[model samples]
Target: MNIFNSPQRKRLFQSMKMGWYNFAPIEEGTGIPLTDQETPYALYYCHQVLPQTIQEIQQASELVGSVLTQVWQIIRTLDEDTLLYYGFPEATIKLVKYDFLAPFCMRLDWCWNQEKGIKKVVETNPQTPSFWFECTDGNNKVARHFGLQEPDLNVQKTLKITLNQHVNRAALNLGKPVTDCRVAFTALNNAEDLGTMRWLRNYLESKSTILPLEYLGIKDGKYLFDQRTKKPIDILFMWYPVEWLIHDTDEKGERLWPALEQLIFENKIVIVNFGSAFALQPKSIFALITDLGYDFFSNKDAGTVWEYFPKTSLSATAIGNSYFAKPILGREGEGGFAVNSGKISVRSSNNDPWYTQQNYVYQELLEFPKLEIDGKSMTQVWGAWLYNNGHDKFISGGVGIRLSEGEITDNLSYWCPIGC
Candidate 1:
């Protein structure tokens, strides 16, 4: 059946025409105008998953979180030479020694083909989980339009609660009242970054302010300040990836090292998705956990880890056959390639200019479930957005589905809404 032909689909399109969902790109030089840019209509139908599936996903997410937490603990024990091999800079290694917020927001990408009978984790973004705007608001609007029911789909409510909880915990660390805490949310001036921040700012306007990330500076070499007002920022929520910032340099060709690091070490600023979370960005960590076996994990966690986690390793020879190779810190499918029978079948053309210096990992390949959408057979990848309360405890925020004709879900993949 063509799901898009229903009355609900037409109503959703009408809502789009009525500007119920609008987007504005942040950059003018990118050629994408500040206008709405002919917004795409969200998926007309909701994709439903069984309750058991949801439970298993949540369990798997928590297991991933646990393994990563242990990885952090293990990193601090490694020598400097070993740390550099794991893609950590001397500065970042120091940050790992301290107890910091991890995975304040994250997403685990999973693929499950019915014939396989198990969901395999494809990748993880433990720092700066994007797509909050679409997953929370757009998903609900689509669900309501289709009269679908999903008890765990209230993402906006969960986001608000989680943000508040994170900020409150930061306040305690700063020894300040939660009401007196000053917060700012920042991202690079790209369309996705800005739009996501704008949507979140709209929801958090009453509690915090939105500002440019460039406004950050150090005062008198002893304190961190918001350059706009030269006032010290108490807490910050960054949409930019922590790894990128670690390698960034100022316009004068000077490295931006230790400006953020010093602030965090001195307790002058509380940054969400804390610096330590960078440990989870690489694919090699999955292989590390896999090699450790189920001895360290709980019964459920052990089973989930073995079932969902893919066979991954830091070396290509470790992957005996068809596999996927990806940069440890790549984003949006960039610097990634699909290898079939030890030959490169597909490679990403969208490599980021800044991420050229990272190491790569080879992972076992898993097939995505085949689904029919818009008169075409497409591969579906489900992303479970997970939030960590800064204490290794994770809560399921919501789910986002991306479909594409190709095997890899890149920046061009379509966002399909989920139903009950």
Candidate 2:
């Protein structure tokens, strides 16, 4: 805590504040936000990490390279209306009020490390929540909440460098030789990732054209290059709600948005970040890993993932229960079915009946390795290794971590420095 008095901390805050002032919202004469049609940005991001843990995270880069080759192969061939799974509960939060315009993408929040090896996707963010922002806010909140300075994840360069790795991979994914694609980052579209898209665009500006979505006007069903060309923009990118594009009401009057139906049938835009990648059967991946002799645990049936290998110990069937249900594509502790006091309480959020996964693999909850931070409670820095397709069999760059103060990580939990 004494580190706050140090000059290093002062410089960091000063830099963040400067970026914040430069990128805050704009006001128009009408007293409404003059939404920057092309770019909407916020600079409330700071980088921090645990050096030793970050080193391991860096090693996880190899997994990104390994997985994306397989991931891209899967996406390139799949139809637009394909379905994927969300391993984390927060991902469900993003789909809480899904729309066609902001329909989900192939957002994955898997942990990669030397110990767990490749494709160790325990959970995912709700469309890749920006940990850098969470790290920034976490630092501010702790300081205010407790009236005491806490170690900030931003204290370590791991924060910026790790995010730099993720975006760099995304840029590489959409870079030249891959159809000369351009990026169009949308706020609240891909949720936290919209902030990340700008960071990625800055990195990509040197390699290729990084155009904000506004530059390529989206009209009717297609992204028109211009009124004159009107052929349709080739590259399609968004982090917005799917509902904005289309929505239909069911007999129960509950609004439902089928983004997959629209994206596949409506246009020819190249959509990366394929949602859920639910089509990739966990059973197959598990078999591959097991065939290779890896010792990780995974449930094959989506019906009973909650009975075993559930997201958190809290979600596990109370001690002796033999039956539990879970969404096939559940993530971040959402859509759980726990057997409580001889009662099966299945939790689900916005999972469309059409795409609801029914498979389940039940297994005992895993004892996720823990990291103990000095002056901080037990923290598990969940690693996210971002991979670009077609570079090599190795993950593109460094990794990101979701630090938590509790047993199960949720809501972009705050993380802090371990060494200092």
Candidate 3:
């Protein structure tokens, strides 16, 4: 049966367009339409995983997250020279040194080889990780359409509770009542980002405001203000990356980030994930972990690190022939290249020169297990969300799956819903 032509599929697409899932059906700026005949962002069918596999993935995700959390802790104590060695900009050094609360949410991208029983986390996004609506509500909607149970039914519920906990913690730390706190969620005025902001804002139990990044203003080099309302922002929940924020400038090309950083340093305003989250944003941390080995991690954690994390290094020659060279702070596969036998095999189609200018880390390549979906062979990358429960522990919120025909999974990759 042609699921795309089915009545149920039509209704599903219509509902998605009507904001039932808060998913952006089109890629911004490119005008590329998704969930359509050409793109098919969400597949018509569902992939079912065994319960044991789900549990294993979740367990591995949490363990890896704990290890990375320790890595962040160590990174916070490093000096400016060492941080600069790890590709951190000089503009961000002060902000990264601040001892802020744990990240509210993070996502670990993993590649699994089922036949060999191997699961490895490729990279971690501690600052901003999207696909909130697709993995939770959208996945359930697709599962129901196919008469299959959604994987992790309580994912949304757990995330909402976790978000509230983080908000309350932030408010308490600022010595402000929850009702008196003014939380502003800001993102670029793009479809995906704005939609993600709204989806997360809906989960919050307190009153919050949503605005674009451009609407933010610096007042007297002390505080950040919402230009639209001309009111001071208390707690900022932004989807903007700290790396990019440091490079942001006003219309006259004057850098506006230093003032913003000053606001954070002075405790005038607090970002949700905290500015120090940028310490873990660089891919060089992977190489650092591989280098330190037992010196940095405990005997047990060192074993886990060696087993799960691929061998990575700053020099390409350090990691033998078949490896991937990726920009330290690149997102969505930008400026990533796969080198097989000392030659570039596949490069990201969405490569941006800005990222290429940054430092690159060479990581051992892991082959992704492929599946035949709708007559197309697709490789899969599993994303696991890690939430800090405010008790010095990281918990698995849920999982999101993406599929791509290419070696590198980028923004153009299809979001494949999972069922159990």
The best candidate by lDDT is 3
Local distance difference test, candidate 3: 0.80
Model 1 alpha-carbon drift over 4 Å, by segment? 1-45, 48-52, 151-154, 201-206, 298-300, 352-357
Tell me the whole-model lDDT of each prediction, alpha carbons only.
0.70, 0.37, 0.80
Candidate 3's residue-wise lDDT over 272-327, tens digit each?
88575677788998998988776668887887797789999999999999899999
Tell me the TM-score of model 1: 0.85
Choose the strongest candidate by TM-score. Answer: 3
Query: Which digits, one per residue and each the tens of the lDDT, describe model 2 over residues 193-256?
Result: 4544554444333233333333444354434343333444444444433323234454466443
**What lDDT does candidate 2 reach at residue 178?**
37
Indicate the worst ten consecutive residues by lDDT in candidate 3: 17-26
lDDT for residue 232 in candidate 2, whole number 0-100: 46
Question: How high is each candidate's TM-score?
Answer: 0.85, 0.49, 0.92
Q: Model 1: per-residue lDDT, tens digit, 1-420?
A: 345345656566456432323234345556454664434434566777566766666666667666566676676677878767766656677776674665577788888665678578888886664656556677767766668765265567777877777778888888988788788777765556655676676655236766677777767657766788776668887777766677788777777766767777888788776665676766667767766678977786787678778888888888777888887777878778888987888777667755545688888877678888667898788777777665667777776777766777776566777666
Ranking by lDDT: 3, 1, 2
Could you tell me how far off, in angstroms, the CA of residue 50 lies in candidate 3 after the best superposition?
1.3
